[model samples]
Target: MKTILITGATSGIGKATAVAMAKHGHRLIICGRRTAVLDTLKEQLSSITEVFSLTFDVSCLQEVEAAINSLPEHWRTIDVLINNAGNAHGLEPLSEGNTADWDAMMDGNVKGLLYVSKMIIPGMKERTSGHIVNISSVAARQTYAFGVVYCASKKAVDAISEGMRLELTEFGIKVTNIQPGAVETDFSMVRFKGDEERARSVYAGYEALKAEDVAHAISYCVHAPAHVMISDLTIYPSAQSEPRTIYRKQ
Candidate 1:
């Protein structure tokens, strides 16, 4: 069976992707900061596929490296890596944004991705085969008020994905970037710093993209033939015209 490694597997896109992959008979090595969540997920999936869980904060470089190194021999040779651990800290204008929020976004979204990829890419290189799926956002392409840092982080992800594609093409490591518009998840709640009401207001107008929607896109990328690599996939709800535009009915 194919082996898949997914970061941020506790919730949102990552969790959805893990479930989708398990349905396809892929052995999963999942990483999350919460051991409880990872353990629970392991239990839930134990009957369907072989699952290995690692608990570590992706934002910490030391933690990421150590956790990956500590993986059992059975989970080391990863055929696919989903770098999906990321966050949007606050929805305040950049001029008055919280430094803490900015740091959270930077560390979790950009550095975290790098740390995990660094540990796993070597194996893919040695095997001369692999696929890296990066979960970017529409914010990566379009900036909005209070979204500067989060946008920048994902922008960095977009750039990194391109750089990986260019550099790893020779190694036959396919890099896929999936940039989803809006999803009804804790993403907004995190951005609003636990202000559920504020977060809910952002999605009042229309049916935003769901976590499963992005998961389907990721599943497609993983199932594609080795020779076929989807460089980037940008998906938006039909009522959504852009990253900042949404049409909500009354």
Candidate 2:
């Protein structure tokens, strides 16, 4: 079984992917900022496969470096790295946006992914075989009012994924970007800054995608034949055609 390391594995797509991968008997290193949630998830998944948990804020380069460095020698050679830890902070027009929120988005979504990848990539280079899956968003393709930074952040992920693929091709490393639209996770809630009503309304009239759907896709990407690499994929709910066009049953 290949060893997999997933960032932000405490909840949503990350957590679901961890569980799905564990069921396939892969060794897992689940990373998150929440210690309690990490411990709980590790205990739960350990029964299915070898499981280790690391708690660190991916946005913090020092923490990301230290956490990966702290892994045992055996776990350091991760077969797959899932860059899945990210969140949108607030919704407001560009002129009205908060700088703090912008920082959070840039740091968490873009810089954080880079930081983790930087730490794990050398090991993969030495092995000359590994897969990197980056969880992007439909926002990367379509931008809406009040979502400029979030969209930009995801766009950066797309660029990074392609660049990494080109740079790592000689080493036989594969990079895949999964761009998911409107999944009903805590994503909306967090973006609304804890406004549950607002978050609920966003998915009220449509059958939004679920975490498990994305998880299944991720697992599929990881398990594909060695010669086949699904470079980029975009998934949306049946009722949604794009980020701005959702056919809601009103």
Candidate 3:
């Protein structure tokens, strides 16, 4: 069975992807910050597939290294790494934004991705065979006024995917960037800092993509033949072409 590692696997897209991958019979290493939640997922998926869960703050680089070092000896050579641990915070214009929010966004969305990828790459490089999927946002492609920092972070992810692809291709490491638009998840809840009413409003009037949609897409990308790389994919809700261009019901 193929082995896959997923960060941010406690909720939303990452959680959905974990469930989907487990159902497909892939051995999985699930990582997230919440130990309780990760343990619950581990319990739930254990009957379905071979799985291990790790709890660590991906934003903290050292924690990532420690967690990897602590992995079971038998599960170290992972076949795939899904860099999905990220968050968006504070929907406000740059001039009025809080520095803490900016830092959180930068740390989680960009630096967290790098830290996790760095920990996994050496193994993939030695074997010269691995698949890496970085979860990005439509924000990576188009900037929104109030989403400047979040958008910039995802844009960095976009660039990282491309750069890694170029650098690792000869080594037979495959990298794919998945840029999804308006996914209905706790993303807005995190962005709005627990404002459930506001988070719900973002998707109230339109049919938006769900976490499972991205999960299915992720499954498809990874399940492809060894020689074929999906490379990049952009998915959007039918009701929105851009973040600020959503057509909501009147």
Query: Which number leads on lDDT?
Result: 2
Q: Identify the superior model by lDDT, candidate 1 or candidate 3.
A: 3
Each model's lDDT: 0.91, 0.95, 0.94
Candidate 1 vs 3: which has more TM-score: 3
Q: Which rank order by TM-score, best down to worst? A: 2, 3, 1
Query: In every candidate, how many clashes are there?
Result: 1, 0, 0
Instruction: Quantify how close model 2 is to the true structure by its C-alpha RMSD in Å.
Output: 0.6
Clashes of 3: 0
Taking all chains together, the TM-score of candidate 3 against the true structure is 0.98
- Between candidates 1 and 2, the one scoring higher on lDDT is 2
lDDT of 2 by residue, 167-246 (tens): 99899999999999989999989999899999999999989999999999999999999999999999999999989899
Residue 214's lDDT within candidate 2 is: 99
Which pairs of residues have clashing backbones in candidate 3? Answer: none
